[model samples]
Target: MKISLKTIIAGGALAAIAALAIAAPAADNWENHCAKCHGADGKGQTKAGKKLNVKDYTDAKVQSEFSDADIVKATTSGISDKAGKEKMKAYKDELSEAEIKEMAGYIRKFKK
Candidate 1:
């Protein structure tokens, strides 16, 4: 059985497309999880954000204060108020290790 040149070209194109799809990273987890408090723009201006007094991730100074490790820890373990009560819910149970690590990088993009 002989394959036509067009068939070979179409197959190659489909393979390339499939490869690109697999290589591309999924949408940031922050949108689904953090955005409610952080805001889609990362300004931390939502009502919950205001109530919790969530820090604006878009602020460069705030971004500089936390290392990537800090971000990862907070994400996995959750944050607390001055009284040591948990304010944020821990994602350690919900997300994978790799996803939590990726979230650290995702949050950094909020910095101006």
Candidate 2:
């Protein structure tokens, strides 16, 4: 097979685009899952959200206080414990650090 230079460049570009496309949805899902409890507006006011006393995601005071590393830790370890209440589970095992970082970015969008 004679692999042309143009074909190689095109393939590399295609691969990069495909990776981004796949990653975008995973990040979106992470955002949505966080939103369900945190509220679409990140206000923690959904009918099914109050049980957890969900964090006020849009609070500028709260958001500004945390560093990106802190936010990623929150997602991996979670802000709540799963003791008395069935809070959201730790995602450290389910998601990679990079993926969680993306979720952290998504979380920032909710901040006021």
TM-score of each: 0.73, 0.63
Q: List the residue pairs that clash in candidate 1.
A: none
> Model 1: per-residue lDDT, tens digit, 1-112?
6999999999999999996544333244677778888888888899998988889988999999999999899989998889999899898877777788888788888888
Q: Write the per-residue lDDT of candidate 2 for residues 9-110, one digit (tens) a residue.
A: 999999999987655554466555666777767788877679778778788897888898987887788665546543676777767677888877777887
For all candidates, the clash counts are: 0, 0
Which residue pairs come into collision in candidate 2? Answer: none
Where in model 2 is the C-alpha error above 4 Å?
1-27, 80-86
Q: Distance (Å) between predicted and true CA of 53, model 1?
A: 0.6
